[model samples]
Target: MVLYLQYNRGMTPTEAGQIMMLQAVMMTICAPIAGRLSDLWGSRVLATVGCLIIATGLGILVQVNDRMPLVVIAGSMMAIGLGHGLFSTPNNSTAIGTVAAAKLGIATATLNLARQCGQLLGTAVLSLLIAIFFDGRSITPQGYKDFQSVAVWALSISLAFSLMAAWFSSRKG
Candidate 1:
């Protein structure tokens, strides 16, 4: 979004910063509330709902165009923020809770490692997709279209994985 705003839309750095700030604000407000709700209600339902909301947000983003309104973009970002806020706390709690006291440190480290690995993998995949799609082309309408296609594919795959997570969370031990 920063790149698109800077390169395609000619937005100033401050403008981009403002847009990102909006997302940050949403995330900050939602995270603790989501965490409290998860504590009371359990992770399964909260996480599942988060995943679905994230999927819906991504689905909305998949259709974004250069001409899309700032409001729409901000709204999508808010949805994503809400989802992440809802998903992270209870998911971490559940993972840590499943381990014995003797293994708590190991479980925490493993969970953090998994998260970093997932981030790395996601970055690599996105980079590969961008390389394949861009092929040395400048940002253009066609390039944006290609990006949209890649984003749709990535988001769809993410949605499926999140749904699987939700399903697994819902399962009895």
Candidate 2:
């Protein structure tokens, strides 16, 4: 989104950064509330709902083009942030809760490992998609279409994965 704001919309970096801050702000505001809710209600439902919301945000992103409104982008970013805020602490709590007291350290390590692996995998996938389209070039005005195509393709794949996570989250042991 910052890239789109800068290259496609001709905005300055500061403006792009400011707009993207909405996502972080939303996440910061949501995490504690979600943690409290998870403690009271259980993580399962909140986690599932969070993944669904992330998928919805990605669904909106899949339709993005150069001409799309910044408001739409901001909203999508906020949805994603809100989703992560709702999902992360609960998921961590649930995972950590499953381990014995003596194994808490191992559980935390394993959780961090899983998160690192997921991040690496997601980055690699997005890089591959960008490479296929951008071919090591910068985003020229003419190449925004290619960038948009890659973004749509990648976000669609992400949306699918989020939906799958929701399904898995909703399941019982």
Candidate 3:
């Protein structure tokens, strides 16, 4: 996103980050609601729905281009953020809840570890995708179209992962 904003849209980092803030704002607002709902309906359904929403967002990103407006990008970013907000608590609670009481600490630690690892992996994947379409330093003006392709491919990969997560989330514990 920062890359696209900078290279493709000619946005400053501050501007790009401000645009990204829409996502965080949506996530912050929705998380508690998702938590409350998860408590009622249980993690499986909410988690599944959350992941599906994320996939939907990424599906939109999979078609993004230079001509696309920030509003659309911001909307999809909110979908991604909202999906994660809905996903995290329920997923964590269920993962931790399934553990024996005596092992709760270990379960929490394990869950956190997995989350960190996933974040690292996700970043690495995105970085690699960017690297594929960009030179080591930066994208040239001519490379905006290449970067667009990169974004599409990267988002498609993420969309696939979200779908898989939804599938897994739908399963019995």
Candidate 4:
């Protein structure tokens, strides 16, 4: 969304769309690597590292204001997508592995619910920040930058939760 909003500035729509397209390409490229890492190490480790990297990327993206927010966002998206690929399948497998077969349904439901709740919280917080910071004035590069800064703050908090989750998941029961 930040990248999309960046288009409201002087950048052309084509350029913004291309940035999104590049994100897709990078995600595709990273998915397999993520899977490999999950296989080699553990899902918890990979996910924790990926989440940290993503948080770092977002934090850095806000600070850098070159004409390259697109590139930066794409890289961050790829890190995140890779983390998802690494964490999701293996984490699900681990969940099932930990629980009895009869409880698999409940486990899956819990996972999905947690995911949705997190998404809801993130969206709500982001909306509030944008409303507070992004005045209805014309969307300028500075406005978009402000949006990015707020987003980084939100993502950092989210990443903290993810890190905690990873740590808990890795603990021996």
TM-score of each model, paired residue for residue? 0.83, 0.92, 0.92, 0.68
Top TM-score prediction, candidate number: 2
Model 2, 1-173: lDDT tens digits are 67767877788999999888988988899999999999999999999999999999989988988778889999999999999899888998999999999999999999999999999998899889888998899778889878778778888889999999999999933
Ranking by TM-score: 2, 3, 1, 4
lDDT of each: 0.75, 0.88, 0.87, 0.63
lDDT of 1: 0.75
The local lDDT score (0 to 100) that residue 40 gets in candidate 1 is 92
RMSD (Å) of each candidate, 1 decimal: 2.6, 1.5, 1.6, 3.7
Pairs of colliding residues, candidate 3: none
**Which residue runs does candidate 3 get wrong by more than 4 Å?**
135-137
Best by lDDT: 2
On lDDT, who's better, 1 or 2? 2
lDDT (tens digit, per residue) of candidate 3 on 17-93: 98888778888988899889989999998899999999998898788887788899999999988998999889988
Residues 18-100, candidate 4: write the lDDT tens digits.
Answer: 65565466556766777676677767776556556555555554444445555566676666655555556566656666888
Ranking by lDDT: 2, 3, 1, 4
